[model samples]
Target chain A: MSDLSDERIREEAKKALREKGLKCVIGWSAEGTPTFASTEEEIDRLSFNRSCVNNLVPYLTYEIRSQRGKTRDGKDKVVVPVGVVVRGCDSKALLLLLNEKILARNEVFIIGVPCSGVVDPRAGGALFRKCVKCAMRNPVVFDVLASETVQEDEKDYSEVEAIERMSQEERWALWEEILGDCIRCHACKRSCPVCYCDECLLDPTDVAIKPDTTAEEKAHRPLWVERSVNVPENLVYHLARLPHLVGRCVDCGECERVCPRRLPLRLLTTKLEKDVKEIFDYEAAKEEGQKPLIAMSCMEDENGFIM
Target chain B: MSKSILRKDKVAEALSALGKQSVVYAPVKNKRGIVEYRELGKSASAAEIELDGKPDTPPKAIIFPQTEVLLTYRKDKDGKFEVTPARPDEREKVIFGVRPCDAIGIAVMDKVFCGGKFTDPYYKARREKVTIFSIACDGPMDSYCFCPSTGGSPAATEGSDVMMYDVGDSYYVEGVTEKGKKALEALKGQLGKPSPEQEGRKEAIVEKAKSGEGFTRKISAESIAKLDNSFDSKYWDDVARRCLSCGACTYYCPTCHCFDINDEKGGERVRTWDSCQFGIFTMHTSGHNPRAVRAQKLRNRYYHKFKYSKDNIGRYLCVGCGRCIALCPASLDITKAISEVK
Candidate 1:
């Protein structure tokens, strides 16, 4: 992880900026928060550590739209890639977004940082649960490699297995307490790389009515979840995110890290990931172009999924 | 004001005694090892209350809950809509181990809810029944505290019922108001007369709090004044470029009392805590949003904390408890945002 010094990352980023005509380089600041660096001085501020927990691949879409960079020169038809510093987990997220056709291959100039794992925000020393089971310590896809690949750990589902072993009542009680703590801030939804939506169904406001929206459309808008922050309503909020994350979730674990209540949010997504892989024999972003499990259903597929 | 001493060994008995009469909310370390103001119950005991450092979260929820119903609406047999005002929690509540910055945050919220043009019936009702027992900080709790810069001190007693200062093995408690004095009556069995040595220690703690030293994170007067002309500066976009547009800052802020009223599933009109950082917070029903960009939302939050609150309520809304800095996923330091405004 230390093979790529902070200064070396800066040097590469500065080179990428000029050669790639990049508008912004999304990276971690000295304090380990995501920051946008455009100038050489701002690029110099870019550093990586075990505290660099945020998966900045999300900003690849946010910092740059389909045109790659938000701020472009006058009448330049060429789309310049936005330079991004991505860890192994983040590179997986980037490839999934690529498979979805949300972003093109050339839309991002990926500066891959080979890493071990980020430390848990709760404990200063303990690695995050996702990091402990990380299968890839090297970027799945990258334009330029920042360092030599680090040793990776075997997948461990013990944390998820422990919860699965809980009795029906115990599991229900655990979720009730966890979801009860939710403030409905949507921090988990906002931080995820793949949760980008023009109009999120989980939004408390059911309808983003346009000027030309039909009366029938307005009348038929379903209030799937209410605005109340109670356990029942919060359960709906989290449940809505579960299905939408079928094959798309890359398990970056940013959701649990950013939670102010410190909810075990990664458990939900990671459990879903395990189930999908065990049942469907598919892993998200395992290749450049892999169809999502939800998209690749056959007639012989189990009808019990509807339940 | 009455003065007394209660040895820390007797603290749990006193709090448990008060718990019989009132639901005592204290800074109890949660499962994650973060201290938050939580109700003393079977899960969290009075003996487990952590009072040595600043709590990870402010104690705003004890008075101003994140989600509360304003009114309930239903239809009768004749189909006529019947609306009833939501009943407010009337239980006697004593918030123990409150830091002074959080106490001052409640004072600011008091101005926002009841002191202004309209008195919020809910806030007034709940605020009336609760009593604050603030622990005076001998100095800054951590590197993040900047209460003195925001019109509060480590020993500020504006919103407390009883002010408590650590005096070695015992606490030097002073009653700040009549309500505080009355609440102290519940602990009379454990109370003892304060000696001259105890009084000297209390004064020393008060003097140190008044001087306001070791607070590395603070905004200057010039910085606050400079914000007057920094409203539309490009600096906000630079700071907010990486903002995730989440409510981590606003929800954790003690003084941030902005809420949205909505009719819920049960035909109840509820007031829920809303964040200025959210993209749709300022969105119009007609598909227009004034603060559409993430940068604009960040700008509006800072402005509300510094400018709008001051213009309307006569003081800055921020308490400088640094909960925003601590809980913020982006590390958006409000002091830095205001002081670095150009």
Candidate 2:
């Protein structure tokens, strides 16, 4: 696909605020960070480039809703629709949000861009690891395309294949080395658009651990996951998050990019992504109104083991 | 006030000599070109030590490990529970190649862990066993450094036992304390007097480090003071809108000391690093969180660094290392945020 000029994208964002009445156009700044352009000046500051790497769909949740305007009357709050510029990866997240009923279809206006690839800021403009094997260069769902749709290369699972070739012990050792360095920052889960749980199960306070409380008194508190930075706890914390991501993960690569330790978190998610595609014969966010693989009937699934 | 010069070539000999008495840690780049502070191997020399800039992770882990077992309890044969302290392997240690900002960060942490009424015995034990060798930065390590603004210089030697200034092919070392003086005396044979040219170069480097060139940004005391009254400012909401609430900024920070203690199946009680950026950091047992909002939590971090720590310890918690600025996923630059504080 041909790239849309930055100026053109800026003008379109400004128009969305003024003409289409968007509360804000979630776009990019010149420094390649997320910018919420609510006014003309902010829209003027909006920029788009190969370095715009953030997936802005995570901002639409109630967690960020405090930034919205409030009314004096004690009435149900009416949310203003926001315009968001999306690359193929972000549009996939948006589709998952729409499919999960977490977000209303008409609530967000997606300004889709046909992305060739985004550059890793840390790697000096090299294509990000997640982008190298991308099968969706065009937005999965968009209200308008900023440019013509781009042709996507056939998906390559070579990286996933190499991991599969590893023996079970070797796979365990690889993950042990990777997760050993995790600081438990939760950057991976926080950056994930599909990980919208208000209280994550991995959080220590969320998992209840009552050890035979008396009839009137409770002593033991909840401890879901141990608060150590060692291998066993970190490994369990990462693997437990996979069940929640069954068919919803978009392989956006934001998790790995945000990691301070630069751990290979995407490799784990990519493994799951490949498994879902092969077993369920489903791809995440491919089309609107489709049920997620976890939500669909098992009878239709190609995995006979489930039957 | 003892001073001497050590040639770059003889650094390996000095390290080898020091290794006989103490475990030596130096910054070394991994296969991925990411620098980390690790213990020197038996065959490794000072050539492997990277003194050019700060490591990706600070040397705070040397004194306060990412995970530490406080104590372990075991059921004896008599059916009584016996508790034993899980003491770290005691060893005299040297951490070389720590930047001045990071060394200052250790001093700031000192104020928290050692200055209070209740000192952490675990941290105190480890800290008392380690000596610091702070290397001077000739100029700005990168585009994000701001040591001068935080009452630190690239040549500041606040917490280091010895300050080593990079002067071309040699290092001009000066002992700042009794410990440093003792270490210098021990390595007297490996050291030599600085030549006139080397002394001149050292002075020039110190001057350049003091110049504003090393600091591309500023976080003035006035701006920091303004933060005291700006808790409810809409600026926080704007700044934190894109924040993923990832703990990268706090985790990579040299002075962040928040921690959580938990018990494991092996009857081990462990304390590990925790971050205020996490949602459950302040979650109440009754499900009442005073700072449940993400913006509120982010705001508290700035206040703690610039306001609360100053109130408690008479020093800002942040040492202007710029790790938070460089690693924040949303590009939430603390220096930029400081400028925006009204």
- Checking candidate 2 for backbone clashes, the offending pairs are none
Q: How many clashes in each structure?
A: 0, 0
Model 1 TM-score (2 dp): 0.95
Instruction: For residue A231, give model 1's deviation from the true position in Å.
Output: 0.8
Worst 10 residues of 1 chain B by lDDT: B279-288
> Per-residue alpha-carbon lDDT of model 2 for A1-307, expressed as tens digits?
2234566677777777787678888888877788988898888777767788888888766433543455688654676778888888889988999988887776787788888888887787798977876887788887777777777887777888999999999999888888887888777778888888756658663322223434344244434578787888888899988877888898877788888788878887788888988877778887889888877856555656655
Candidate 1, DockQ to 2 decimals?
0.54
Fraction of true interface contacts that also occur in model 2:
0.60
lDDT of model 2, residue A219: 43
Candidate 2 TM-score over all chains jointly: 0.92
Fraction of the real A/B interface contacts present in each candidate? 0.54, 0.60
Poorly placed runs, candidate 1 (over 4 Å): A66-79, A205-221, A303-307, B41-43
Question: Candidate 1: what is its chain A TM-score?
Answer: 0.89
Provide a comma-separated list of chain B TM-scores, one per candidate. Answer: 0.96, 0.96
